[model samples]
Target: SVDLWKEAAMLVPEYFENTIDIWEECDVHWSPDLEFDQAADPAGAYADLSSDMTKSNSYRSWRKQLRDFIYRDVTLPLWQDETSDLYSTPEETESGFRMRVVQAIREQNDLEVEKLKAKFKSKFESQRDRVLRAEEKVKREEAQYKEKSYMSLVSIGSSILGALMGRKIASQTNVSKGATAIRSASRAAAEKADIQLAEDKLEQEQAKLKELEIEFDAEVEKLEQRIAPDSIKLEEYPIRPRKSDINVADVALLWMPFAIHANGAKEALFTINE
Candidate 1:
């Protein structure tokens, strides 16, 4: 059986009145520890009702319902007023001045973050454009080089064929001399060298393109790291309270087995079948 309770109707109004009174008339600035102590004090309506001394689970259920109401109706309004006057207190204590200075520092940090984001965006775009342009130029040059190499190979083959034909014609006409044969052989060697030189040049260009590709990737990785969400650290002033910090331990036995015999009968039936 689950028991329900409405503590908000019974207790929240009075608690809220006390909280408002404390906020208005109280000159003492409540620290996080003091705030926590007051919230969890057994004298508090919800805390008292939800204490271990309570026999009904209704008290535990009441605690849950009252928590949100108390915070919304009481805590938030008080905190908002406190935060507005946090740095403007007439008494300039060491902690008060420090908080003011911290606020200024955080504002400056916000500006710095904005500047860094803009700078990173500009640099990333410029670098990306440069890399893309360089890649495009390399592609264009590679295509031109390939076409030039094809033409050069064709020219070399034509020259070698023409030389061989001339040598054959001279031999048929009985006009071929040792000098002619040597000149023809020298021309063939020159053509072969030209082809080898074109091949070497092509290889060098390919290597250069590979190096550029590696450099482009490295630069891109560097830019990504600089612009990544984890890379930027924004300054946080004072610590914000976590949900766990606000949690008050529940003391009620919320679940009660009103029909324990039904569960026992099901278990016994399974045991008999086994």
Candidate 2:
């Protein structure tokens, strides 16, 4: 599409060059940027200029030549109607279409990004709650593990003392006390293993929560980049002033000269009152 537009745009300058040649040959002169001459008589000067332009011999010669050229060489083959426009006028065309296109694309991307952000936000929030709960559970388990470990150490010390006292007494009652201490030591060791298992499980859950949070943040950043406004071209087309309502000065200075010199050369079949 861009290549096609470039090719078309290239033809515009070629057409303008041909028109310029005709304009120069006819001694047609004007400028879109021509400022009002402050030193010249503003009132009568315009009238004199208008009369001189319409009465020029060069203007007459070009008008006849160009009419002949268009009817014979250009318009004859197409056989178009007199009312049909040969070329588009600048005023009739729309500007800023490219900017509008860019805006539309940006808007679509923004909407998609918002949707993704909402989805990720919801997921992140849910996972955050889970992480918080897991952290709290881990804290409780750690405290419980500390208490069980301490009890296990005390049980082992008691078993050692009972065994020593039984050996010294050489009696049945001291032996019974030693056996009870051994049973207590075994239960404490089992509780210690359970506590260790709980701590390991807590560590695994915490690691998973950390990983999930990192993943969520990374995805959110990706979505943000996808919707960044800098991704689209924002250059705008230049705007021209509207000329729908023609004033008297415009007719005398700009419109009349242009129509007489350019459009008049074509020997238009119909008059352009508007």
Candidate 3:
């Protein structure tokens, strides 16, 4: 028998249900810097995480294409039709469909054309109401599919989804002295995983920037080794934006929920000012 967790793409709620556990997991009660991914995994605990990361990224890219088709192509025309009430009755819809067919008939007439027209008439007579109901059903399914697919991505990343941009948020003003830390093995693992994820994201970006700088340096070095010194020196490459440009406030606003899921809503903070 397959475990249900296998069916689920991600299992975040299991990790971040308790508020106290998260702080202890990352050892954040002592130091926030300790929550980095390097500190999270004790040995080689996160080894199994790559399969999930690849699935989540690929699914996101695939769903984006599907969303375009459903929203841009199928759903909109039916939605417009519904809003306009353009085909309120089977007769009206059938008549409109007939007019288009007849217009086609006028352009190219033949016995085969008459037979096609008769077939359509017979279909309308037999299933006009059914056709109208099916049209409505198809539109509903398309709308539902689009909504579900967009949400599926969050669940797919079961590790880091705390909440989303459009959803409602809890007020931090109602704080309790109850937000104390916990000390447990499982909780520690969850907090560590959260820290690891953030660190991984940061390092991935840092590595990309570092690679580009190296490539640019290599080219510049080759030019100096070959060309005359009188050659117009290439302008110094502009530095990439420092991680300091990142708005800690903005990041905290976004990352709290992810930490909530990753570390059990443990009062996680991305930045603090004196």
Index of the highest-TM-score prediction: 2
- Give per-model CA RMSD: 18.4, 13.8, 49.8
- By lDDT, highest first, what's the ranking? 2, 1, 3
Residues 1-274, model 2: lDDT tens digits:
0111100000011122124334223321222234343454333222233333454564555445544433333211111111111222233222333334445555665786677777777766776676677667667666766776676667667666766865765467666666665776676576667667666766776677688778866866665554343443332233322233212121122322112345445232222222
How many clashes (backbone N, Cα, C below 3 Å) per candidate?
0, 0, 5
TM values, all candidates: 0.27, 0.41, 0.16
Query: Which 10-residue window of candidate 1 scores lowest in summed lDDT?
Result: 265-274
Q: Which of 1 and 2 is the better model by lDDT?
A: 2
> Where in model 3 is the C-alpha error above 4 Å?
1-188, 228-274
Residues 13-82, candidate 1: write the lDDT tens digits: 1122213232233222222221112233343223123232344544555456445433443321111113
lDDT of each: 0.42, 0.45, 0.34
Q: Candidate 2 — which pairs collide?
A: none
- Cα lDDT tens digits for candidate 3, 1-274: 1111101011122223223222122211211222333254233223233243344554454344333332332211111122112222222343353344344433433444455556555544445454454555555555555555444443434312222332323323111111211213334445445555555555555555566556645644543442232332222222222332322211110122223346555544344221
lDDT value, residue 139 of candidate 1: 64
